[model samples]
Target: MQDIAREAGVSSKTVSRVSNGSDSVRPATRDMVLAVMDRLGYRPNFAARALKRGRFKAIGVAMFDIVATGNLLTLEGITKAASDLDYAVTITMMGKGQQRSLAAVVERMKNLPVDGVIVILEQMLPDVGTFVPPAGMEVLLVTSAQSTTMSTIDEDQYGCSTMVTNYFLDRGHRTVHFVSGPEESLDSHFREQGWIDALARRGVVAPPVIRGDWSADSGFNAGLELAHVKDCTAIYAANDNEAYGVMQGLAAAGKRVPDDVSVIGVDDVLRNLIPRLTLTSVKMNFGAVGRRAFRMVARAIEDPQRSRPTRELIPGVLVERSSVRDLTR
Candidate 1:
């Protein structure tokens, strides 16, 4: 510190402020100190800092799977939020069951230098009761499931599902068929329940749901089955990938979208990749959920006394496109 301070023509205190990213230091002085440090190959001792302050200025994020689109987007949001708050993030991917247990993962995160941890819930973490955090470890769960023990931030899956189902119903479709995601997913369950509730409200008998693995291939397979059902006019896919597959299957079966089988999906991801399809989907702000989850973790870390377990739900909006056809018109 003294060498860098002398080299930059600044006091040791000024060097300390610059190293800590204090805004009180003038921009030019900060830059000069940074340049001197770079020239000297100086790196801040995070371990010592953590030991002194009882914080690492870092957070750990654990996910059961990283391949899902929703998880990917949520992670993006988390990193952005963490960066904005000047905190570092360490990510850990837990492999499939028995391969890596939640207990083991939590232990690993506890060993990390992070002050708080955020766990992105998946099939593995279905029962929060089974998992417990280390002492004084602040934890947040990003999931649709309700949890009384941990803070949670999730997208309004049920409400969005109802909106899409009602969207098809209002278009004069007798009933909307559903292509659900994997059975184990809480998100899929919520969406499926919403579809059922929507149908029940209109006194319409809900059709059998076609199950998918949250994949375009699964959707295509479900779509092929729907093609065989003559009365299948409107379809609500759990996600965009499934909807895309359904479109393919319908096309292969000589079914025209909107004109023959109207389709809607959740998670507006398909529009960005398949612009020509013009898919009408429920737009979920997974990014916002991620950001909020990070903020909650930060609060828990910074002010543990005031931080309480809270559940926050992010709403979804229906993005209209050319996929649904109005029969009443």
Candidate 2:
């Protein structure tokens, strides 16, 4: 500290102000202090600074994995937004049991200087009332899950599902079958609701939904079952992977897609690479979900007292592909 002060031709107190990012320091003085610190290899100790501010300049993000395509895209948005704001991000991976896994991470963060936390809901099954957030820190829950109080940013799962269902019904199909994600999943549940809503609006009876764990194999199994049914003309799987399975199952049964049955998926995953397999699906802007989550976090961090708890919904666009035929005509 003394060396930097002497090199910058300023007192130690003046050097301290620049190091702490105080706006009161004169521009020339701040520049001189920064230069001296850089030349002297002086690094500000964030831990020490955190103790003074009672908050870390970094935000903690909790998610299951960093590798999933959707998760990775969302992460990119979060990192980009945080970088633009000059904030650091700390990512914690929660595996297996939710109660134990996430609670441990939260405890660890409590020991550090994190200013806020953004909990990504993928693979997160937190126990009821498990999150006891830190007293002076802000918390944001970024998820597709529904709750009245939690701040969330996600797609309109219900609306998009209804759109797909209506697509089939309008085409003169009497019933639409749904290949849903795990029953415990709220995303899957909301999508199912959307399908039912569409059926009700059209005055058609909604058929029973088949279950999948968001896996290709599960979709394949559900497809095999549906293939045997006489009136199963269209299927809306929870995601693209499952839709691929549906295609395989239909092919094995000697049924051609859009001819025997049309398959629609939620995600347009890598659709351009496979020219022959035209998967008509919904294209969700997951990156926008991530961006919105960070924006909410930033707002909460900037003015914790005035920020209101709010939920933001990002809509999805349906991409028409060969997988689904316009049966309305």
Candidate 3:
């Protein structure tokens, strides 16, 4: 700090203000200090400074699987939010490829020097009881299951499936077939229940739900089977990837989309991957969920006594495209 201040012909306090991003400093002085900093290759030692201030000014993020699109998008939101808030983020992949006990996560994070943690659960929490973070550690969870101790954020998954199913029913389809994601995923289960409940409301019995592991291959198999379901006219896939596979399988089986079997999916991400397929789908605001989670955790950090909202749900919107057939007309 002193070296940079001397080099830039400014006081140590001015350097401190510039480093901390305080708006009190004049723009010219801030620029001069930053230029000097660049010339000297001096970087802010956030961790060291955090230790001195009694607050890390940093948050840890734990993702079960960072490879998942939803998790990655949420992380993007979190990093952007943290940057804007002048905080740092450290991530730990708790469950990389297999299931891990909550106790293990607690143990791993016990000594980590962060004020709080944002956990993104890629799979359902193990049958283990409550997940209690280490003492003095605040946790904000992004997951599908309920938690009493940890704050959680989720998309309105139930509402998402219900809306899509109702769309089909409102279009004069007697029932909508379902292609579900992994059985262990609470997200898939919630969506599947939503579809079932919606169909039940109209006194329409839900046919068997085809199972997919969120893989295009699984969706392809589901498509092949549904191709032979004589009266199955509408399908609600667990996600856009599955829908894409279903479409490919249907095409290979001489079945035409919308004309033969109207299909829809969730997550609305396939359009980027397959530009030619005009698939109707639901849009999940994954980044919003991430930003909200950061805010929730940050609140717990800044004001330890403040009571935070236990749960928040970001809603999904239906993105209309060319895949579904509207028979109501």
Candidate 4:
């Protein structure tokens, strides 16, 4: 520190302030000190800093799958927010099926050297009672279920699902059919419930849900079946990939979108590639969920006793496009 200060012709205090990112230092002096440090290849000792601050300056994120579009986007948001807050994120992916349990994952994360932890719920856990966090460990959840023990952040899946379905029903469609995600997914659960609730409110019975594995291929198969159902005029898919596959299947079956049938989906993905398709979708603010989760975890870490369990719901908006036909028009 003193060497850099001497070389930059500044006091040691000025160099220290610059290195610590303090705004008290003059801009020119801070620039000069940074240049000197860069030229000298000076690196701050993270271990020493952590010891002094009593924090690892890092957070751990545990998830079952990272390849899913929604999970990937949420992770991106987490990474961005953590970087902005000067915290590092360590990601751990738990394998699918019986390879791991929620209790096991929570225990493993407790052993890690992170100041806090965020759990991304990709599937329904067997028992929520067994997934308790250790004392003093800050924890957050991103799931559809309302949590009473930890801070939870999620997109309002039920409301968005109902909104899209109601949009179709109001357009003179007798009823809205659904393409659902995996049976074990909480998102699929809430979205399907929302669809059913919307129909029930209108005194109409909902059609049997067509199940998909969150893949375009599964949606294609479901679409093939719906194509044959002459009364299936409106379809609401759980996500955008499924909607794309449904569109392809409809085209192959000699059905025209918004003419013979209208299609709507959640997750406005791949909009640039298929602009002509103009698929209407429910757009989720996944970035907001991630940022809020991080903030909650940070608060817990700062004062665990004062931080109470809170639920944050990020709402999705309906993006209008050419996919759905307005029969009233």
Candidate 1, superposed: residue stretches over 4 Å from native: 10-13, 23-28, 97-102, 124-127, 130-132
Candidate 2 regions exceeding 4 Å error are 9-14, 22-36, 97-108, 123-134
* Candidate 2 root-mean-square deviation in Å: 2.8
Could you tell me every candidate's TM-score relative to the true structure? 0.92, 0.87, 0.90, 0.89
Candidate with top lDDT is 1
Candidate 2 residue pairs that clash:
56-113, 171-327, 171-328
lDDT of 1 at 320: 91
Q: Model 4 TM-score? A: 0.89
lDDT of 2 by residue, 220-257 (tens): 99888889999789999988888889988888888889
What TM-score does model 1 achieve against the real structure?
0.92
Evaluate residue 61 in candidate 2 and report its C-alpha lDDT on the 0 to 100 scale.
Answer: 85
Q: What is the C-alpha lDDT of each candidate?
A: 0.87, 0.80, 0.86, 0.85
| Residue 44 accuracy (lDDT) in model 3 | 85
lDDT of 4 by residue, 246-268 (tens): 88888888889979889998988
> For model 1, what is the C-alpha lDDT against the true structure?
0.87
> Which candidate number maximizes TM-score?
1
Model 1, 1-329: lDDT tens digits are 99999999989999888877679998888998999999999999888778767889999999877878899999999999999988999999876554455566668888888998888886645347666566678888887776667788899988898888888889899999999999988899989999999899999988998989999999999889999997889999999999989988999999999799999989998765764767888899989988999999998888888977888889999999898999889
lDDT of 3 by residue, 205-320 (tens): 99999999888888899999999999888999999889988988998898999999999989988767775768999999999998888988888888877845497878899999
